[model samples]
Target: MIAAEQVRAFRGMTRAGTRSVLIYRGDLFTGAVTLVIQVVLAIAVWRIVYSGRPPVNGVDGTTAVAYAAIAVCLQSALLPWQFSSLPMRIRTGQIATDLTRPLGLMWQALGQNLGVLLARLPLGAIGLAAAGLLGALLLPPGLSALLLAVIATVAGAMIAMLCNLIVSMVAFWTLEISGPLIVYRFGSSFLSGSLIPLWFMPDWLRASIEWLPFQAQVYTPVSIYLGQTRGAEAVALVGVQLLWLVVLTLLLQAVWARARHKVVVQGG
Candidate 1:
């Protein structure tokens, strides 16, 4: 019953053509632009860093280009900004009605996000494939690696959603959440290997970040695709993501219960 309501909410959002098209178009444009930038950046980075070297740390120019392209596609496709709106919804009290729904508000939010993701996946794939071909990057391995990458990416998204929910829930206790959200976004991009790969970071910093949840959001899945980590390590990384997901979900539930009691639904 509750699941059905969640599904209905998701369908409603997806079926709303204006909203759906807006999201799809915006993400498509962003993805396309990002691919262009990534290609250029890849060439620059490779030229500067490799300096005619065959490979640095076993990663050649082709591999480096491929990694950059993949990283860009992942970053754009993931659309971290989607979570930024949560605090706004909370601040404006739009979350009150959401809280009153039969289904859990977080689950409904998750469904809506998933719908946007579904709408963007095909376009994102096309952008990624085109960029890969242009950059001469190796294709994502066979069926097994592709399947693993998909599973890992989904898990990464779940972790991202959980983190966003946690941060957004802060509006329940404070009126000013913008500062914290900004910090979170910055940290996610830098520490998650979205802006810079972990491989390039100092050993101590990389080790430190491994313990943080941001790595699970972007680095883990990309590493899996690049074969940086495999087998048990890959499994362990996914496990860590799930662990954080559960913890964040529980925390959100507790916060929502408190927030719901204080909700003052405005205007209809």
Candidate 2:
């Protein structure tokens, strides 16, 4: 277990990062507006698609809209833009300073990314509220579901961070990470049900992606939020998320060790 002091220090870093985002909130205004527009457009299309149908793949129009709204709001948190520059930092040798910090490098990175999410929460909540007011989204089913969704969403975010960390660490070996980054971003966004519900996908494809961590990142949390997952199934989903967390954490540690050794040997 991490000692109290270590946890406190990590929290301090998180708060500092959060403050940085707040200070420069204007820089993200355009992106936030774009997200809102996308949410509106997605709801509009789904509305037309489900107009006459009672349900498409077990999701009715109302549930579909709610899912889309929540997914968009959480998208920034799940796949933060801040982390996209990690590979660039690696290439520019800024990672050397990061390594020299007293905190564990992985913790610092995760804390900072999470801070970005925290900073975005207020605006995200407003966007969701606006969508709800405009009849494009549904309120969460119940308090219990909302609480459970919060937990699930946090787990999802952690999974996303770990995956991104692993991807960014590749920069230690190769300067060109664009190709891999593109593949990862698209694959995760599509397969994770951030753009569309996994239930709407073909059976074969859905079944295949279900085993991957990408689905656990968005679909599971959204489903829980919508009350589509509960009881034992909800427990199982959280268990699967925990399992992946352990696996990814171990993989990251091993990779970071190799990366640090490479950096040191190269006179970084």
Candidate 3:
């Protein structure tokens, strides 16, 4: 059974998150506008790549658009804007107060982050759906494929949060994490196939990247969504995601414990 104090802590965290959302009203609008620009850019790229050829690597214009649209949507939904702020909080001793709360600090952070994602889901979905429709002839995934994609995407988001937490914990030791965090974000974007589909890459390169944790972020779910993997292959990919999630979660827990021990409350 859940403790009442934990419940109250979660509620407090949720309220703080809701207030933060209200404060950043512009982000909601800006995020929507950004989604539009991304879709247009994706469409443009699709046209350029398929200008002469009817299809690229067995993927036609429709499949390309769907692929791009879903990629944009997933990135928007999963990317955390507070990765940088986390280190700052730790450095400033703000995390000290957070740690004092009844709930686990990392769990509270995850709840707040999830709240933000939930807030953006409606707009993100609408923007992606509209873009998909406008692009026309999107390749439709079967119901089972869609279900698996959803599961993978959720797992991917959890993995991303764990990674951010682990990276942010560096503030306890290094006092600066921005450089490493930026590198991590760039590496994830490129290696995870967020910038380009893994299917478009050469077989050997794809095989090597598939084993990396970055693929859990973007490529795995997108592959499922695009119907690029199915049946046993899809199951295997999801298993990989779950395995990574567990590993990352445990790793982050260890880091959080060490960081908490090293935390120096500058004031109070």
> Pairing residues by index, what is the TM-score of model 2?
0.91
Structure candidate 3, residue pairs in collision:
none
Q: Global lDDT for candidate 2? A: 0.81
TM-score of each: 0.82, 0.91, 0.88
Please write out the lDDT profile of model 3 over residues 4-97, one tens digit for every residue. 8787777776666556665777877887888878877887787777777877677777677677777777776666455335567766768777
Cα lDDT tens digits, model 1, 1-268, are 8778767776775444225545567766875676667656765676567677776666666666666666666665555455444566677777767767776666666666665556556655765667655654565656666677778898887777677767877876785787888888787878888777788788999999988888887888887887767788878888898888887778878887877666643332
The full ranking of all candidates by lDDT, starting with the best, is 2, 3, 1
Cα lDDT for residue 207, candidate 2: 89
In candidate 1, where is summed lDDT lowest over 10 consecutive residues?
A: 13-22
Candidate order by TM-score, highest to lowest?
Answer: 2, 3, 1
Residue 256's lDDT in candidate 2: 91
Question: Which residue pairs does candidate 2 place in steric collision?
Answer: none
How many Å off is the CA of 233 in candidate 2? 1.2
Writing each residue's lDDT as its tens digit, candidate 2 over 154-250 gives: 8998898889889988888887887888888888889899888888888899889888999889999999989888878987888899999999999
